[model samples]
Structure formats: structure tokens, C-alpha cells
Target: MLPVSSELTRSTPVVEYVIGKRQYRSLLEVTSTSTIRGVKKKIEDKIDKPMRYKFYVKILLTWSFRQLTWTGLQENRSLDDYGVRNGDTVRAILTRTSVTRELALDESSPWRKDVSEISDRDTGDWPRRLLHIPTMKSLTWRPGNRYGGKEGPEYEAPEYAALSYTWGKYRDETAEPISIGETEWPVPRIEPTHFTVHDFRRVINRIRRYSGTDFLWLDVACVNQGPDSDEGRLEVGRQAAIFRRAEKTYIWFTTLSEKDWPKSADPDYLQQNIGLFEKILNDPWFGSVWTLQEAYIPAYSYVLDRAGSKLPEISGCGDGTSFKTFTRTCTWLNHYSDTPRVSAARDVVPLLRKSGILAIDSGNPFILYGAAARRRATNKNDRIYGIQQIFGFQLGNTAPNKQTQQYDVNELEIQFTQELLKNYPVGSQMHVFAGSPNFGRGWHANEFSELPDKLPARFIDIFEEILRLDIRRSQNQDQQNRRGLSHLQCLCKFEPRQTESYILGHFSGQMCAFPDLLEAVPESSKVELLVALDYHKDSEVLADLESSVKYLEENTRRYISLYTHDRRRVVSNPGGFAFGKRLKNRHKCRLAVLKLGVHTRSRERSHDVSTFIGLMLMQESGYWRRLGFCLWRVWHPVEDYDKIQWTEEEGYFT
Candidate 1:
């Protein structure tokens, strides 16, 4: 017979245990040497329950509120062996018992009801308190089944894991229905047929098998896609919230193969597999505008390969790894990839920065949009709608309370830019226009050209003039020359300058002499320079010289300040100089200006010349911080400043 002690003993240690919402403090005769089973018995007696149900005692090991790692107390070990202290709080979590049941999808199934009905609130006159998202079918796992069966009353928001994937080209019209116990439920119909039921089944099965969760919130099955349906529109608007509420999000990269994964234990093998890993990351899923929020919003997100194996969490990739690490690796990998989609991948940086997932100093939406312009979205309006969440706007509207307003694709694009300019500082907005490649060219030209009168015109005029020159020059050039000219145009667009008087005055006052400036100027301009110097005493020419000098100094300082504050450091490859560079010498700040390309006397080659100036400030630690960059064509020598002219007839700076 087992010994039973019903009375409270003074020598017993007091322990606090939590079961669901209830907390219990129990005094027992169990010692530090007492096994976990002994403690469980005490808990059962305190709660007045039989020990027939299986439950585990879990202790919180980490402080992460969103994703606390809970370690289970070993039943065979003593309380002290598992690190249970006198007053430590332990949570009892009951595990579901194994049961075999038929999975049936009928009208009574929770998924069949409208989302609005699921909520308990009945706001009769209130303008639909919450969005009515369509109910999506989810599969639950059953114990003792090889192919786990679906078990669901329908998942409440925050109860299921969400899936993010690229549909690719496999848009089958119809396939076999998924088996739910003995009955088969018809797959949710999707128009334009982007995926089949078989595809859905594979994803559902994999998620259930690996995650040990039966219910999954998949966009393809859950979101109604009818063009005119209110359900579809509402779902689109609530997308951010849906993803944010998910317990965990699973990102499925179709291109990732099981064979390519290197053994984690093998260092040499992992090194060789880095290239393949990078290539796998470059898959189209990373470039999709819609997946950006799906990847970042969830508290716990996992990347799954084709075979359902979880890829290493982005944080687990290590400092030696170089897949463009962000503050949170999972967020970075979800929103970015490599190579073919580098531009689109970079666009997410500013959004991440804005969302607080990245450092606050990173650039804003206006600067990022240019890089994202190349990303593909089947619906052109999605280009604008996809990033609304990042800007703190609800889907289809700038704010949640505002009435949903549908606009044409072009109008939506214009409104997005206008909204950005309205919210952020005008100076930063201008700087983005100056830095982005797509802002003042091709389709984006008209948007920037029609800026509201409140915005300063100095920067806009500069971009317009540069763009006009590029367009005129390209009309006469071959395909190769046009491509080179296009690149030059982008460089011209990014040339940083300050139009604000207070900041401009401070920058203009700083003086630095360049002895080699004359040598860098074209020789043919020597005579023109002599002619200009002869008239230096003239007030107009003298004023022009001083004004030009002030402009140059201010522009140089502006670029440097922007570079120092705006650029991301080279964390992975410290030696590379692409984004920013650290100096080997630590004593003082170094300023270097180089004339890029050959200075030519020919009128045609003048357009090809550009100046490259950089400023590097060295910290006491001996590392250099890159401060700024200035790349632009100097039409003529500063000595002949008055002679340098812009002519409509010539269509080029002369």
C-alpha cells in the first residue's frame, strides 16, 4: 500500500502552480529529493481531480513575451534535479488524449458558417464592428492515424498557423478532394485556378505532420477571390491583422529541395552548401509583394522546404553566414532574397526599419519604393496595396476608420506617393526622389512631376532637368549607349543636395581646398577659363563664382551626412566597400574626391564624365565609417563657371 499523508506538515516546502487561469499554493511534505510524480500527486489533490488525464509541468526559461521557450519537467527526476525552487511558478498544461474520430464537413461544421456569425457581438446599428472574413477550412491531426484526419470546430483568429508560399505555374482547375475521415469535402473554388486541391492537401498534410497542429489558415483556401465580392475585399483589408494574429506562420519555398540541405554537423559540407543555400533563397517567393507581411508579422515563423523540414531560423544562421542578415533573420529572409530580386529585396529594408524590426536610421518608404518598383504583382494596384501595412495603413484605405475607397490602379499609385509626402518630412521626401532610380523616370515621371505646391520645387526641377537631358541624349544613342546613359541618369538622380537655408548655410561655411581641381578639368577649357578670369572683377561673374562654390560645398556636406546616417554597415563582410567601409587608419576623418572616367574635350564625352567624392570619419576604435557620396557630371571647369551653359537647342550641358 502507498503511504498517504493528508495533513499539512510544517517542514513541507510551499510551491505555487498555475493551471490555466487559476493559481494554487499548496503546502506538502515532499522534499527537494521528491520526484516530479510526487509533486503531481499533490497538485491533483489540491485541485481535487483524478490523475487519469496526462499533463506536463512547464517552466518558462526565457523572457520573450511573444515566444517564451517552455521546458517540460521530467517526471522521473526529483524536483531539485529539474531546477524547481521553493517559490518558482510552474504551469500545468494538459495534453489532448489520443482518440480516433470521423472527420466530417457538413453544414454544421464551423467552417461552413460566415465569419460574422462566429463572433458573439451583435452590433445592430454599428457599421460592422469588425471585418467579415470568409471562413477557411483547416485540417486537424488525430492520434493513431497514418494520414492524420481533420478535427475542427473552425479555428478562431489566433488559433491557427498561417502559410506563405509561391503558387508558381501549377494552377490546376480541379483535382481530387481531401479525405476527411470517411467523407471527402469539396475543395474551396479559386478562380483563374492558381492551385489545385491536391496542392492544398499536400500543404495541409505537411503542416499537420510537422507542426503537430491540425488547423492552418492558408490564403489560397481562406480568402475569397471573387472580383466583385465584399468578402474578398474585406479579407484583403484585414490581411495584416490575419497574419499578425496567427500563432505561427509557415513560409513554403517551392524551389527549396531536400537534397540541397547540408548536414548541420558537417562544417566543410555547410561551407560548400552556402552557394546552393543562397540560390535557394533567391526563389521568386521572396520577391512577391504579398508575402512581405506574411513573413514578418507572425510571432513564430518557420521556413519549410518541399519535404516539410523546417529550415534554420534566420537568427540561427550565425554571424559567419552572409544571406543579407536583418535584425531578425526570419524577417529578413521572409521579405528579401538575392541576385535577380536584389532591388525588390532591398525595398523591404526601409519598411522593416519603419516597423522597428530594423534599426531606426534606415531610409524611409519613398527611398525604398524605387528599389521595389521592379517587383512583380499581377494586379498593378497591388504594387501600392501590398506595402500599405508597412506604412501603418489598412488595406484599401490609408487608415482603419476611413471609409473604404476603391480607386483605379494609376490613381492608387499616385495617392500612395502623395500620402508618403504628406506624412514624412519634405526634406526626406526630396532626398528619396534624389536617391531612387525609378522615381523620375519612365512611368514614375508623371507622378513626381505633379507634386503638390507645398513641396519645394528646387529638388524637383533638378531631377526634371537631369531626366530631360537623359531623354534627349538617349534619342541619338545606340542600345548600348542608351543603357549606359540610363545608368548615368540614375546616378544623376541620386546626387544629394540641401535646399534648406539653415542647413545649407552651415554646410557652405565649411571650407576645404582642392589643389588638383584645375588638373582634373579638361585642357580644352583652359582658354575659356582665362577669358572668365579676365572678367572676375565684374560683380555678376564674381557673384556667380561665389554662389557656385557655396553650392558645391553644401552639396558635398549634404551627401556625406546622408551617407553617414542612412547607410547600413557591412556586418557580414567587413572588408567589402559596397554599402559602407571602415578605415584601417583610425586617427582622423579622411575626405577623398576622385574624377570618375576620363575628362574629355569632346562635347559628346562630357555627358559621360562624373565626379565621385566620399567622406570617411574614423572612430577611436580604428574603424572608419563611410559618411557620404556625390556622383554627378560637371558640365565645365569651375574656372569658367559663367561660360558653362544649358541650351534647349543642344539638348545637353555645354
Candidate 2:
């Protein structure tokens, strides 16, 4: 025993210590001068454990296993003699002898009676008819008789737990045949020395004991991987439903071991254990594409380390007694901040939150597309098909169904975008465009270039519409604005009445309307009408402005003037003109300009000139009820319009 120093007894500092790996919150604080034997007594008192069993303390110096060392402390010596300090970890390992019988792995094992094989018919219909899921009889000790039972009644699908794990590289020669009751199933080719098979056996046994059910749904054993068939594709489509309907989902991380667990009874261990749990969550299982839905959709989920030890459930249901109830409650709690403590397995919470959003309103599937793009899939097509169910698209009936066109990735992407635009409003459509690669990354330019070649003719028209709304003029100077005012005049021979009266407006004084001035201006003069529209808050008004701009753009030679009060301009260029010089002076030419409001110094730099044009057209045509004033500006066509560097002051018709 080490000798205790005289200073240790004089001033004792309270030190926090963890008892075991499972109890993170069950921490005990004792003074530095407390004897090892005295600390044990306190632990017993805190845990309500009998003193008949012996407990030993070992310090954890580092998180890595290589750096971990155990130093035994004599029961009679104080912690100060062993160099114990405040906030140091002290692990308690029960030394009492207890016999734990391992489950026998023979052919006649009792678990064999509960095993069932998934039939081909069950795989055909998939989630709609979830009966007879496959279960492995034993992880080891394979028997020659693959099918142990005689002809019997077909097993109906029952409540079962689903396994989510990564399948590392495997070879044909490495495959092992394991018995599933009566059928001999070939286990994936995993190396034997790695103890994956052994760990799987232990996991199955523990799950059975804890869940009180022997039925389990493992993808490798359940899905038929036969070549030259569409069954695999069909199964992939039904993945969302399969995981959502499961009683519970188990996420098995091969990287986690006994070293990562925290004691359930030690409260001080809670802080230290967070780092270990974070490492466990970083395992490749969380990154796998197929595991995203599996980790989230189920009513209850649990995580297991390599040692078959279960991690604390992150979510809980109401009543908080059962794991399922606790998970349900925790899921709701995660949405709020009252409970700031995040669970170690909270990585899957985002997927759960998204699932809830999809269920409530799946009109905009753009977010789902973005989420799917971030994940990886073995088959390129599976990238889109895999997330179809999450967006509420049904995986049509079995083979020979006419709806197979939906499975095509190209067709599916188009359909998804089309549905998004159709079901949502114009603002939401803009948001989808902002999030999608086609518009977000400027990839739509390439799509537009391909035009009616790679894309459908209808899509070409759609692209044209979007372009007209986004840009005042296309790159090609020869083509007139397709939907401009000239086109509107050609389509409908309509004339407007002169407006001599004025009304109070929001930003500026009452002014004469533009339609009244149009009749007074000479037709031969280089006259241009500038219509400043309100593109601030109303979506309907914005849409009208877009239509009016398209009409004005068709007459390219005619000077079209527009100004805006929007602080942050949505459109890059408002007017068809290259520069704002044409509206700089009111004496140069006949130009009728309207101003609803003035642009502040901060907003002048990003102001959209076209927004004013659209806003003015809406007000003059009586399509918009808002008040505005009509002012006149002189147009001076610059010799080098493109070369002119117009400042913000000259850009706004002040």
C-alpha cells in the first residue's frame, strides 16, 4: 500500500468518479482523502448494492485502447496515496464469480423451432404482404440437413425486428452455409477470423431474449438476389414501407466495443461517455445509403455495439417506462430545446424529422431530392428510385404492371420536378429551383441549350417560360422578347384610355397615369414608356409584372423604361436596355416614366429596373389597385450603350 502524505489529510478535495461503463449519470463524489475501502462503501450505499461483493477501481488515462492502463488501489489506502485527483475517472469492475451459460449451437437447439424461411411468394409481393420473413437458425455450427423440418404450413408474417448493418467485401469461396430452420442459406462471404459471425450469433440471441420474439428480418436472407429478374428492383422500391412497418430496428455498428460503453449508474461518466458515443455514431453504418430510412422509419430503434451491448435509446414514448414509449416522447422532445442534452445516437433524428415533414405535406419533394443526392447508392438508378416512397409515390403492383415507366430514373426526375411545380405556388417553385441542381448550380443553362433534343418539346417551352420570367432579354439579340408588349398588341388589338386624374399613392405624390400621356406623345418621336410595378409583397402582382415585361420585351427597338423600390432585387436585370442611360434626362426624348417610390441609398445598388416597368404596367392596365405617380424622363440613346458605366444615382429615375 502507498503511504498517504500529511497534506492529503489536511485538505480534501471532492473528486468525481464513474463506477462502471454502463452508468454515465450515476457518478459519485468523494473527498481525495477518502480511503479506497471507504469509497467502495459509499458506492454500495449509493447503488443500494450489498457489501458481500468486492469492487475494484481502475483509472482510464486515455480514450484509446492502446493508451488505457489499469492500476489497482489497495482498499486500506486513501485515493491521495494513489495520485487520485478531482474529475479523474475510476472504473469499477465486479470481482464476484458469476456463471453465465452460453447458448448451445447444436441442430436440436430450441431456437431452431422458432426459425422460419422467407418464401419466394412472400418476396414477390413485398411490403404489401409482409409474411414469412427469414431468420437464421444459428450463426455457427451449421448442420448438413439444410431444411430440418418436414412439409409444414406456410409461416405468416409477424412482428419482427429488422437488422441494419454494413456488408463488407466478400468472396464466393468465403461464403458459409447457415441453416434457417429447414433451408440451408449461404451467408454473405465474410472472413471467419473477424468474429463477425460470432458477434451476429450473440446479437440474435440477445435480441430474442430482450424482445421475446424469434422472428427477424435480415435483407441478405430475405431478398432473392437471383440474376435476370426485376425482383431486386421491386424490393428496393418497397424499402420505405418495409422499414416503416417494422416493430423495431436495430443498428449494428461493428466498430463499437466494450471500451465505448458508460456505466448507467454513474452520473459523472455521462460527460466522458459523450465523446465515446460520438465516435461510435461516426461509424460507416451511419454513412451507408440503404441505412438512412432503416435508422429512422421504425416506431422504436436501438443501437448495439460489437459486444452485443445496447446503447441508451435516444428517443422515448410517453409514460417513459417502455423503450418504444420513451423513444416516441424523446422524438418530440428533440424538436424543442427544453432538453438540451443530445443523445449519442441523435444523428438519425434529422431523418425522422424529415419523414414527419413528408407525411404532413409532401407537395414539395425538392428537399427529399436534395437529401437523396447527398447519400450514396450502389446502382445509379437507385439514387432516385430509392427515395420514391418517401415522397409518397407508390411502387406500382407486381410485374407486368403498365406503371413500370415510373421506375425509369430519367422519367422519374422529370416527373418529380413537374409535380413540384404543379402542386406548389410560384414562390415555392422558385424555392425548389433554388435548391435543385438544375437551377441552383446554373445547370439549367446546359439543359436549355440541349433544348427540345434531349428534353421533351414541352420542357423546351417550360424552359423558355422560365427564361422569359428570369431575364429581360436572351443572349441572342435577333430574337425579340417572345412574350413582350408587341406580341400582346398583335394578339389582342386593345387600346387604353387617357388618365388625367391622380390619386394618393404609398411612396410618391399623386401623378397622372401613363396611358393618358401615351395618346399625347408623337408616334414618330423616339418615345419609350417606363412602368414601375410593385414587386414587393404580392405574388399575384409579381406574376402580372412578369407577363407585362414579356410583352414589353418583344418590341426590342422601343425604349422600355422601368424603376423599382425593392431593397433586394430578385431579378438581375429589369429593362431590356443594356444600360439605364436612356432614362437619365427628361428633355432628350419623349419618355413617360412612373415612380411608385424612391430607392434608398442602400437599396439603389441592387435595384431591379424591370420591376418598376412591371409594376407600372400593372397599375396602368387596372390589373393592380395600388396607387402610383406618372413622371416623364428624357431618353438619350448612348453611342456605346454597353460600354457606359452607369452609377446607382443615374440608374434610378430620381
Candidate 3:
């Protein structure tokens, strides 16, 4: 490939720039003519401390790069707004991990392999947009077991890579033939390994020190810029690959050590150390499970927010793209069903994979054989110890120097592990699994109290199967680029509920659909006449949804039907989140869309055009066909509801 872009090491001394967290220092000088995003990456390496994504991380330009200076940059915007020259100390900083940790780094490890540097020709007018320095020459790059772009006892470090695209090529989505360097250009050897790149400015000082490159690989840095457009152009799959390649990947959990951080610009950066783990999941290998540090777990949910009624929004990892992350580097690598459940069953996609760190999938899919994916890998090593460690992360209980919010995280991990040991490890692989809370005192409400005795044996067997499956692919999982496992099914489950009339779902237990559709509203409103309940305006409407559900439980007897459907969307991750049919053609959604108490039945089925469903009845009186129109009628506590249903229908119907 003819080079559309190139970098050169200046014969003159290289000037260092101190911007935000990153300090920019490179052998090759850059100009404002390059790119705002590219310039940000170069600056990322010099940071002395680890910082989270600035959200909109900025570069305070200073020093004179031939022409560009801090004052000039503040006055104008855009890389092309001005030009940069060699020997210019362009101070720039990105809150993201811009430094590499070289201090006290275990240099004596047997597996250490240093990054090899690029030759003179490798840098000048290089046609290849993807620059890879398989080994860093300047630093005597050696793979190490501790961390950074090095190897461990069980694995060798993958080469460092960085991609440079001249926005011109990528700006066009429908461009002619695909160019890997253009669309998804893979940077040759930059940090010499993905681990060093992520932990660069964060754990240590310079990107070059960790490997040998001034450039940083950041998803936010490559985007067109701005939240809306950046989201559209960002390729999470590629980003996932980059994280997977790293020895340690940083995850952003919504909850921060302090409430001010989110609005403060930098998001939380939880480290995930999956070094040897890289070999376990070879799908576009990132780094080793051990080399991968932090073991960060970002929580992504498909939860809904309640305004007054229900605000349909998926909670945690809101969309599954983040969930589909490479096994070794993902958010909430493991979580229980009740920690916080998704509003939709399909939202399970991101949470279940090896990288997803999930214990369940679509709430209902677990019942089907589809949830058996957990059986593909057996964890011979005792994760129980690790699970206990997570429990140690109790909130407020955290030590003086520790973050307080960590407790919530540990609870989530423990819950997930407990569910897995009880259900997934049985001889039978769980194709679907659901999680809920283990509460105060009532043994009957305890999830396990009701479990059949055989359930434990079944769980053990399933766990064995998962180990065997992982063992078969262990070679790939442990290979240089840990190839991740796929073709695995995800599971999701919910506690059963009693069905109520005028509302969709069974009437015996917790409304199966309630977990997803449940919403609450303000208690103090003139509309209180409608619900006959007073709820606070700010309290989550779910609190009210729960109340209304209880109201229905105590007074109503009728039950409407429920069913499942498929759909897809990508909010943060990738196509990592998708819809799947757990129960095909089963009657569901017969809902209490409108509450006209006392089984207000309407004979006339309204539609833009009717009869679409009429002909099937002629064929046979199947159980489904025997059922009437699908409409949920609820029995409201208000007795007056019975008085208004027979109002004179349209003249013809009357």
C-alpha cells in the first residue's frame, strides 16, 4: 500500500509538551497539518499519572512548533487551524492513560521480551498506514511477567501496533474498495504490545519507555470528534481488539469514587489484567490474563428509567456493544442476575461472552437449551478464592485510602459467581439463567431453598462441560493472540409472578414481563385519580410500579398472555447486543395498555386494515385460535370502573 501518511524522527532535538495529563515527546516532529485526534495521541504518552477519558479531553497547546503555540491554539480550533514545525515543544494532554509504568517493573521475569524498534526506513515515507514495531529497539524491549508490553511465565507479548488514517479516506463510508489502513488501519508496532499502550501514561511515564512510540491507541482519539458523530464512527469491535491486545485494559464504571468525577470530565478507569487470559481467548488476542491488570469491570445494563410511568431504556452497559468485548478485557466480566437486570431479554448478548463477564442472558432464554455456552469452559483453577476477594470490596467499609463505591462492585461479582456455582456447574450446561436478590431473613424467598436437590449435581456437571470445552480451545485461548470463543449461547432469567387481569403475564408469581416493563410515576399529582396512589415526584417510578403490581396482586384474578420477540441496537459496545427469540409465536404482550376496570372487553379489533388474522381460524380450532382478541383487561380497585363500559357504542355497533 502506497503511504498516504508518514512520520519522521527529527535530526534536531525533540521538544516535550506538558498539556493535560499526557506529555508529548516524540522523535518525529508533527504539524498542526496532521490531525487534532492524532496530535492528542502523541500527547498521551507523556502524562505522569493515569487519568480517565477526559470525555472531551483537551490539549492546551503551548511552545512554538515552528508557528503553532498555546495562545494560537486557544484562539483557533482544528489541527488545520494552524501548522506545527519540528523542534516545537507542543504541550498537550489527554486525561486518558497517557503514561507507561516502568518503575519497579519486574525486569527479571523469565518471560520478559522487549519491544523492537523500527529501523530508519520503517519510519520515513512508509506506505503502510499500520505501523508495528514487533520489538522496541531503543528500550531493549523484553517481555515481562509483571505488566507492560512484555511476556509472562505462560505467554509472550504481542507486537505493538498503531493505525493512521487520513480522515479523507475514512470520511466516506461508501467509498470504493476497502483499505485496511484507511477503514480499520492496524498500527504496526507502537508500544510493542497492547498492554503497555493502555497502561502507558497511566501506570508509568512515557509510551516510548514502555515500548517505543509517541502515539497512543484510543477509540475516542480516532473518532471524527463530538459525542454524536464520534459515537457513529467509532468501531467498538476494533476498540475491543485493541483492549484485548493490551496486558491491562481500563474500564469505565458509571459509579465513581466521587460523584463529582463524571461531570468533572474524566471517567473512572478500572484496570482489567488479563495476561495469560489472552491465550484463553485468542479471538484477536489482546494481552495475557495476568499481564492484564486492574481486572476492571464496567457495568452495562439494559435498565429502564421511570419518569412518571416507564422510560424505556436499557441499563448497565446500556447497549451490549461493551458487553461483547474480548473475554480477557470487558466490563462486568462476571455479574449475577439480580445485581441489576436488563429491561429486555436480548440485552444479554454483551454480558454473557467470555469478555462480557456475565452470568445470565435474555431472562427467558436460560430455560431453553441455548444457555449451555457456560459449559464450554471449565475453570480448573479455584475462582472461589477470587470470588471471595470481590466480596472484600464493601462500600463505606473501604479503608481510609480506598474508594468507597467499590463495595457495590464486589457484591455484584460475588452474586454472579454464586449463581454460576449453583446452576452452571451442574452436569447440565445452563442454556439460560436469571439472577435476583437474596434478601432479609425469609428462607422461603431464598433462591436456593426451593431448588431441587439434583440442581446442584447438574450445575457441577455443566461446569465440567464448560471446562472441557475451554480445554479443547485452550491452545488458541493461550496462543499469542488469544482467539476468543464464540458460538456460545447467553442466558437470562426472572423470578416468576402471579398473573393479573388487564395486565399481560401469568397471575401466579412476579409478573415475568414486569422486570422489563415495570415503571413508576410521581405520587403527588392530580392524575393520582387515575392510579389512586400518591408517589413522590423524584423517587424512581419503579417504586410505584412495584406498588401498583402489588395492588394488582391483592385484588385482581384475571391474567393476560405474554410472548417474546427479537430486535437489535448498539449504544456503546458494538453489534455485541442483539435480539433473539426465546419463545417463538407464544402468546405474549396481551397487555393492560388502558385500564378500563372490570374486564372491559371490546369485540371490534381495531387496525388500520383488519382480517389479517381472520383466515387462520377456518383451518382448525387450535388452542391459540380458540383464544379471542389479544387485549389485557385489568380489574381496578375503583368500583366505578364498571359503570362506563356499555356507553352507547358507535351508532352502527349499538
Candidate 4:
């Protein structure tokens, strides 16, 4: 024991170790290139106990007098990879590992590692787990600065593709076993489960083979749907950002079970029977509200069958870009079929290509809510959550309720509208747009839903018009950029009267309420009688309605070109023009006005010459609900300012 051999000293270096906060330390002789796992094996041999499942290794550092800190190390990496030297102390921190195989993604999976230091957690750069398709391993991926800053060359994030598909009804309500790495873990039977074990195996194998995507983020397997659902809710909040940052988003259509299609089709098959292709393309996948954001966010999105084969017809449209494919498909489908689903698919094309660019790059939500109007979701809140990302904002608190496992759609709408207000400048006329006739929410209003049929399939036509007219009008980019941000120029705020019964606003000329409103009109009701604005068979409305339509047309023409192409639809289509048309007897229906605020025709010209823009509303259960947007001039001058009581405060619409 007096002298150790020179060879032993050269080959094995003594490394110090501190277990947890205990002062006890152990010295182990190991090579400089020994892996963290290899050292852990030596420690287990010395103690005759296994620590892989119970402890994580960390390099303990002492900088100044009694100043101590530690950096966690990956078990598979070597000490040399982290630049750990001999005599450096490493700590073994005790931690709990996932004990059951039933948990879809086990925290103790060998392929998983924590890589939080370099990740941008603030922007949701990290997903909880990623399924490594090549290895068939579900790896835990925590990306944030939450862990102490530990710089290393070995620990770096990998690029991944994300799956966007509707969670269809389960084939059978039974637990299916999935092989995660070498372990066969049982997938839990949750409501709205996506795939059976057989289906999952067949689909993922195809995805890997066809798309050439090695890493995938499939929600059904990646997200935890069991008891620890808090983590699942957190994952849901980060989903939009995850999709935005993903290398590619695969739009998964039907599995095309052998029973249905028998064999995969080529571009010729789709070209030969374009109707079946249209039917295939218009699967429930395209009808999903969630898929809208999924389809539009990524830089490159490929439409794929569950078999993992890219839709030959769509991928063949252009150089594999969705914008090009959607444009060509919309043109082709116009001649092929005019089914409701086909029309809905056509409506989504422009939305994905707003500002004549990809909607994700342009950050334009001009038609976001409108695009979502027709898409279906089992949950009501998804209508807002689905499209909010296109607007460059994500609702942090939109997770499903804990007890009910659903959302309070009413409360969620308020938060959504408020967030939308932050994105636009003050005095935005977007608030005045008509919401979905089916939905009662104020934020649901927009021109897209009002006249969906009127929209031009090609948004580039409108974008070109704006650029061409910009030279003539000499409009600046700033003005053009902020087009939809403000329409009611000199808008003043107004408050609703607190009384149970109060006059809404005065109407001009002899008028009669609609037959439906006559039933709701009561002596004690707040809206005693909704004075009808004369319905003109040719124009939007006889008098008051013309101003709103003109402003909508003019502003859109100046900034974007959608309205110019379909001005007639705005004027004459019974269900397309005004709130009155939403009711029965479209020709006889009259627009009823509820005054929002007064705005000068031109503040530069004269503040005295002002026109008040009112909301086109309908009475329901003694309260008024907005049906569409309406504008009209005030017949009487505002001599008594106190009686009108207009302030610059915020005006909320219902």
C-alpha cells in the first residue's frame, strides 16, 4: 500500500462524490472518459445497491469560500463531454421516477434527458415529450431555464414534426399496449381516444417511411391523459407555439382502412376520380377547428393519409407548399364540385394566405374567427382557442375545467375579446363587425362569416389591388398596415343605461318592428320597440345601412381587396348583408339599430358634423344581442351634451 503502480494511476483517476446534502463522501477510481452511467455502475458495485431508478447525477462545484452549486448530468454522456476533471465532486440527488408502465411517458426512460438551460421556455420552445420514431421511444423533453444553467456540447434539442388530427371515436374502449422503447406500456382508455394499438403501429410506421420525419410529437401518445392531467393542461397551452416552431406539420386524414380503399392511390387515381379525392380530402380532419391552426402555422405543411402517403394531388399542386396547393386545389374544386364541405375548404384557402403571404408570417387574423365559424369542435371554447394563434396571441387560461373537464365558453369569450383588443390599436372598428348568426358572443362578428360565398378564392387579387391603388392614393405602409385596426375614426364611448327600461336610441321616419321583435316587445322591456330601418332590395339598406357598407368596402379596398370583388353580395344577398336577413322573410326583414357611439365624419373637417354608428341588434330574453354591424347619421344635433353623456371610456358590446 506504500506505492501504487504507475499504470493504475495513469488509467484510473480518483473522483470525489457527495451524496445529497450529507457530508459523507466516496472516492472512486475511474477513467477520464468514463460515462456518468459507468460511474453510477461503479458506485452501485461499491454499495451493492442500484441507484439508476432512484438517483440523478450532478457535478458539484465549489466556487468561493463555502459557495456551492451543482449541474445535473445526463447518464449516457461522459465526464469528458462535460469537461469534468479528476478530484471534482459529483452529487447523487435522490428523485422519484415513474414506477408504472401504464403512464404513457415514463420519466425514467433511458432515452430521455433534461435539456432546459439552452431552451427558450418563455416562448414555449419545449414540449413535455417527443416520440422518436426510429427508436420507437417516448423521450421526456423539458426545455426551459428553470434548471440551473449548465452548458454542454452533448445536450442539444432535436428538430421534430408535429401531428395534427382529430381524435376520432375509439375503435374499442379497451386499453391498448404500446411499445415504448423496449417496454410494452398499456395506453389508457380515455374519452375521444384517437387510435387502436394496431392502428397506431400501422400509422406511425407509414409516417416515418413516407414523410422522412424521424421525431414526431403526436398528442395522443405524447401528452399525459391520465390522473396527472395538470401536466396535460400545461402542454395544451404550449401546443400552438410548438406547432409554430415545428419543422413540419403533417395533416393526417383518414387511416383509409383496407376495408374502405383497399390500396393506396396515385396522382392518376386522384385525377381520374377527382370526386372521390375531393371526398377523401374533405374528411372530418379538414372540418376540425383545431386543424385550422395546425394547417396554417408551420412553415411547410403536408397533407397525408393515415398510411403516411402525402396526398399526390395536393402535393403535386406546386413545389409542396400548402399556400400553392390550396390555391390550385380551390381553383380545381370550383369546377369539380360545390358541396358544403368543398365550399368550406375553399373558404379556408384565403385565410391561410392573408396579406398575400403565409398567415403565420403575416400575423393577420382578419378572417380568423370567420374561418373558424364553420369548423366543428365538441367543446364550444375551441372555436376561439383554435384560431387565436393565427392572430399572434395565445390564451394562457383556456385549459379545460378541472372538475367538469370542459370550458366555460362565456367566460373564455370575454378573455379572448380582451386579448384581441390588446393586439389592435385604440378605437378599432373590428369590434363593430357582425358575429356568427349562430353564436351570441360579441367577438364572433366579421365579414367572412356574413358573406362566406362572396369571398374571392384568390386573396392575391386583392393584395395586388391594394398595391396598385397605393401608388395612386400615395398611402404609406404604416397606414396600410393598420388598415383594420381602426375604421370608426372619431369614435366616442357610451354607457348603457342602468334602468331596467330605457330608450335605446331614437329612429327617424315612420317605422314598424319586425314580426318576431313585436312578440318580444313589452311595456316594461328595455327595448320598447326596435324601429326598423327600411330594407332596400337593391342596396345593403335603404338609408343608414349604406354608410357602414360603403366604409367597409372603401377601407377594405384601400388596405385589402376582398370587398371589391364581391360588393354585390354585400348589397343584395338576403342572408349576407344585414342582421335583418338573419331572420325569416329576408326581403321584408328590417335592420334594427342600437347606438354604440358618435364619430365625426371628418375630425379635420368639422367635429360638429358627426355620424353615430350603431350596432344592428336583435332582442332575446329581454336583452339585446348583436346580429350585424350598422351605421346611421343622427337626425338631431347634440345640443344637450349632458343627456347624451358620451365619454372616451371603453364601450363593451354584447
**Deviating ranges (above 4 Å) for candidate 1:** 1-158, 168-170, 174-199, 262-274, 313-372, 395-405, 422-654
* Candidate 2 weakest ten by summed lDDT: 486-495
For model 4, name the residue pairs that clash.
434-445, 434-446, 435-444, 435-445
Top TM-score prediction, candidate number: 4
Give model 2's TM-score versus the native structure: 0.39
For every candidate, C-alpha RMSD to the true structure in Å: 20.7, 24.7, 25.6, 18.8
Ranking by lDDT: 4, 2, 1, 3
RMSD of 1: 20.7
Candidates arranged by TM-score, highest first: 4, 1, 2, 3
lDDT of candidate 3 vs native? 0.23
Which ten-residue region of model 3 has the weakest summed lDDT? 610-619
RMSD of 3: 25.6
What does candidate 2's lDDT look like per residue over 592-634, in tens digits? 2223222111123352212112113223232233312222222
Instruction: List model 1 lDDT by residue over 383-442, tens digit each.
Output: 666656544455354333333466667566555654443332121122212222231222
Candidate maximizing lDDT: 4
Misplaced by over 4 Å in model 3 are 1-654
List, residue by residue over 1-654, the lDDT tens digit for candidate 4: 011223223123445543322112456777658887898788768656556465554443211001122245677888767654433345454323332222233344322434433222322445667777766666665432121112322223455677887763333455655656421234454332355566666767776775566677887667665544666665666676677545556666664432232122233443444444344445666566677677655545666655556654344455444433643444444433344433433443443322122322222344455556555567677777776655445464534334225557655655565554333321222222322332334433332332222233343322222322222122111121111211233232232222333322222221123322222222121221212121233432333344433433343332212222223434322222332333335434433443444433223333333343344544454444444433323323432322223222222234
Residue 496, model 2: Cα distance from true site in angstroms: 37
